[model samples]
Target: MANPMKIRAAVKDGVTEVKVLMSHEMETGQRKDSSGNLVPAHFITELTVVWNGKTVLDAQFGPAVSKNPYLAFKFKGGAKGDKVVVTWKDNKGDSRTDEAAIA
Candidate 1:
């Protein structure tokens, strides 16, 4: 299993701001190992964010993204104590889901 992602969500003036830090190697195939072998591309390909059961953000990523990606976003219509969920799927079929309450 991959490491748990760090997430923070806060609502202010009816807008919710979210920040996430995901832990992953995010290797690109273009890189090489010490033995001069190509590293397989391993990266998050899809990510989704939901608030109160409604989808707020849906995104796609590629190997170009840096390791341990950090994401920040804002959306309308969230309140304190609302549930915010985040899920990500990597190219290797590994997926992780986490949730937090709006503060």
Candidate 2:
């Protein structure tokens, strides 16, 4: 599992726009290290966003995603003071969950 992550989110109107910067070393198997050996691919595979316990979005990722991925999206039906939760899981079983108060 990943160390505790930091989440930043906000709400505008009836929408919640969230941006998450997860700390990770998303290693792609196609990359080579200083020793010229192929590094095993280890990247986030799943991501989901929820508002007030209702799922708003879900996605699956691959090695192509950038390191320490930053995701931004908007969800409808969000209200002020609602709780927005973001969670992710990596291929190595590392996971994280974070929440921020809307508005």
Candidate 3:
């Protein structure tokens, strides 16, 4: 079963710090299920964080990352009411996008 993800962020002093928690099984394809079936590998492929319409932090990940992956990073040039967006996609092409406004 896949878990639900949570995202957190804070903007202060013109800097925005963001955290993302993505819920996934992250099967490595080498694993076997209780029924002895091979679990196909499925993991995060790319992740990006955008601040005020600009890409601030970008990353690539693989199956080794871990289940319920956690990502944290910092960005610059922001203030109250600014928008910060984070998007991530899995190897299977599944994706999710979320945003937070500077407070």
Among all candidates shown, the one with the greatest TM-score: 1
Ranking by TM-score: 1, 2, 3
Worst lDDT 10-window in candidate 3: 1-10
lDDT of 3 by residue, 1-103 (tens): 3444577777778777878888877777888889999889998889888886789988998878888888888777778777778788888988888777777
Give the per-residue lDDT of model 2 (tens digit) for 11-75: 77766788778778888899998999999989999999888778998999998888888888887
Q: Which stretches of candidate 1 lie over 4 Å from their true place?
A: none
- Considering lDDT, which of the candidate structures 1 and 2 is the better prediction for this target? 1
Local distance difference test, each candidate: 0.93, 0.82, 0.80
lDDT for 1 in candidate 2 is 63
As a TM-score, model 1 comes out at 0.97
